[model samples]
Target: MLKTAILVSAMGAGLMVATVASAADAALGQKTFETTCVACHGAKGVSVVPIYPNLAGQKEQYLVEQLKAFHDGTRVNPIMQPMAAALSDADIANVAAYLSSLKPE
Candidate 1:
């Protein structure tokens, strides 16, 4: 019985670690941003264009919510709607994580 308890505890801990690992990956986010967001948002989440918002150092939850809104058509924008539509939920989370990690200029 003690052995079974230990095994179950170990399995639970492994699952928790896996969950944490899968929650967000900033490196993956950077790759996606390079391919998708570099044009408007610049190299490090600072937008080159005056109209585009700077994403660096923004709150992660806010970024995630806005992106989801754009993806769902709740926050309509001609450019961002389509751009955000291409991202999955995981991609949004990762991107938000990456952007939030940056220091705003």
Candidate 2:
């Protein structure tokens, strides 16, 4: 039916909008990383410190989940917990997208 078709089209449009917003936020994420994460994770997502895990080439979903866990105390890490605590959901998504898009060395 035309009504069903319209609903599907609206859903697809909504997805497209979300995709565009996420892409825009990825740029914001890079800035945030430079300001906050580069000290540990490096500019390319490779950590200069062996103790810090390299974030390059990670799955976006996994990164999002881990960040959420770190924020919520489901995963315990002194550093990450505090770091993630400062981030909003959008920030988490943005950073995860940016990190996951990188190629590992």
Put down candidate 2 lDDT per residue, 1-105, tens digits, no spaces: 999999999999999966754663678778777777889998789998899999988988789889999999999999999999998888888888888889987
Q: How close is each model in CA RMSD to the real structure?
A: 5.7, 3.7
lDDT of 2: 0.86
lDDT of each: 0.91, 0.86
Residue-wise C-alpha lDDT for candidate 1, range 10-49, written one tens digit per residue: 9999998567535898989898989999899987999889
What's each prediction's TM-score?
0.79, 0.77
Which numbered prediction scores highest in lDDT against the true structure? 1
Q: List the residue pairs that clash in candidate 1.
A: none
Candidate 2 stretches with Cα past 4 Å from truth are 1-24
- The whole-model C-alpha lDDT of candidate 1 against the native structure comes to 0.91
Candidate 2 worst ten-residue window by lDDT: 17-26
Displacement of residue 11 (Cα, Å) in model 2 is 11
10 residues in a row with least lDDT, candidate 1: 16-25
